[model samples]
Target chain A: MAPTPLAVSIAATIASLVLLFGVLELVRRRRLREKYALLWILTAVVLLILSVWRGAVSGIATALGVSYGPTVLFAVGALFILVVLLHYSTVISALTDRTVVLAQKVASLEQRIDELERGQDSES
Target chain B: MAKRCLAIIPAFNEAGAVGDVIRAIQRERPDVDVAVIDDGSRDATAKVAREAGAIVLQLPFNLGIGGAVQTGYKYAWDNGYDIAIQVDADGQHPPSEMSKVIDPVASGEADMVIGTRFREEGGFKSSAVRRIGIAMFAWLVSTIIREKVTDTTSGFRAVNRKGIALFESDYPQDYPEVETQALAHKHGLRLMEVPVQMEERQAGESSIKLWGSFYYVVKVTLALVIGLFRKPIPLPEEGGH
Candidate 1:
């Protein structure tokens, strides 16, 4: 609140750097899609800025009339998580619908091919 | 030109009853082509259906009833069948009573025909819980579609070419019976209900359970409400392949 501790500031900076690198590494490996990676990268950059500017959290919290500064960070983080999870849910629902359609199409085509092969066998 | 009819029986591990259902259709509607979509049944449902003189489209894995039924619609669309009749593989929908459902769709009176059990005085009616569930759906779907659909859960239905194209493109994944009517309405497809006799499952127990019924109602209600908000799919060009 009064002044940030050196150890805590150092820890936060390291953590933000680690987060940023982790996201970049995932993107490099093609593990995380660019669409989602962009979100994580933005989050990492914001954390990096907040960690470097010692007064930013407390200053923002005070402007918003919050007594506890870190609590505000946690609340905002939780809200972000909720929104991201909902996004995932919508994406998953779409994927599920497409998967079902693809399965149905594959089955129909397989049946047709089987029928055609049977007809060829009979004709020959 | 005579309208080519294809009977679609979506079966899942109903090997014991599927044969009888297929045989009945073949015997009664000899002119109608029967295509059984065996939804990855653990039993020999595909083989049995084929042996019974039905064309079996075997899925590599289980895709629930909705996906299985949609596959049948895809076949109807791909093969250009004029009418597609949905007959359950459990033998509940008697192939002899098939006309009551098929006639409306075949005659151009309705784009889709739902064979309702509530219309008749006697048949293998569902339990109290299922009746309540069905009644709730009947009220909700009828209000949404502005049509009296007595049996919202009846699988014994028939769809014309328009209905086939709609379902082949989009269908709900689970418990699709009730929501499909709303979808049909949104797509501007005319629906009709005809009285039909349904038999008890010839071999296995009913697939529905108490908890499953609760889930079914909640999920379908959500689907219907969401359906109201979503834009309706434009019906494909009439008589267009």
Candidate 2:
């Protein structure tokens, strides 16, 4: 028996929804952050479309002389790493600024204590 | 009413020895008015100080030694007292020798007088841990301030108008002794020390345990050393009276 068009469409839709939910779960568990989550969700939706219409993607990859599987995997991996590194750098900058503020506070406190000591000694 | 000296005693749950300390100071120098700063005491320290005829200034919260003493300085400054003495409520510092520390200030010879235990035959006798801590702190103070301070952590001290004004304005809240010494030097105040013997605490155990003492010394030493490089703090508007 041949696969019907309605059955193929339903399977494609289900596969797309499952991939979207899986990506969102990764985000919720912090295995992925917001930026990476958006990218992953988009990739998964595109992959679902390609899985349904493999002929178009294969045609494009063949014209570009690249293996479709390896190319897509590399694109996703690179994007994830770049986004995470950018996030880490932002965090480090914030921590450095906080450390500078704390050092200033400590210095100010020391000076105030010094002034008080002088005042006391002179009074004596 | 005659102008009398106000002795500020910073007490923290010193119930066992606070009464005796108050009575002893009163006996030694009855002319001086005493105010015990009860720093959120959990025990009957407030009652004991009051029973011993000391005016109790109950802090709303615990402010440690620095905050408690600063409150006393503020009280003395506001009340028009001629002098303020920062004496421990613990019996470690003998009330009998309070006069020796106070007389110099009374005679106008020194602006601040610190009771130096090292000057006497028997110096401080805490645990070996505390002794090493004190010595290291003393070294740090001496190096930064260019004065050979024998006692860097002695609590028995007296302050006149200038000293009171200084403390009232901006006193330190942690590891005060060494920081106070460096501050005194920076302000160009006449700092002097007198020979006095300090006894062990009569009632409670020392708040600084062995490991705590080590941390205290290291922390204060680093603070004082860092303070040496920093610019001096500007005097407050109502300071140096």
Per-prediction count of colliding residue pairs? Answer: 0, 7
- Cα deviation of B116 in candidate 1 (Å)? 0.3
- A1-124 per-residue lDDT for model 1 (tens digits): 5434556667777987998888766644446544465556667777777777778877887888888666555665566667778888997997897689788888989999999999999999
Per-residue CA lDDT of model 2 for A1-124, tens digit only, reads: 1222455445655767797778766644445544345545665666566546645444555666665433543454456557657867996896687677668767988999999999999999
**Residue B97 lDDT (model 2):** 88
The CAPRI-style docking tier of model 1 reads: incorrect
Model 1 pairs whose backbones collide: none
TM-score, model 1, chain B versus true chain B: 0.96
Task: Give the best candidate by lDDT.
Answer: 1
TM-score for the first chain in candidate 2 comes to: 0.46
Error of 2 at B39 (Å): 0.5
Residues forming the 10-long window of minimal summed lDDT in candidate 1 chain B: B232-241
The sequence of per-residue lDDT tens digits that candidate 1 reaches over residues B1-241 is 9899999998998999999988899899998999999987889999999998899998877878898999999899988899999998888899999988888888899999999888778886667878888888899998988877788888988999989999988877677788789988898888898988899878866656776876566556756765676676665554453
Q: Give candidate 1 regions above 4 Å deviation.
A: A1-124, B237-241
DockQ of each: 0.05, 0.02
TM-scores for every predicted model: 0.70, 0.63
Worst 10 residues of 1 chain A by lDDT: A27-36
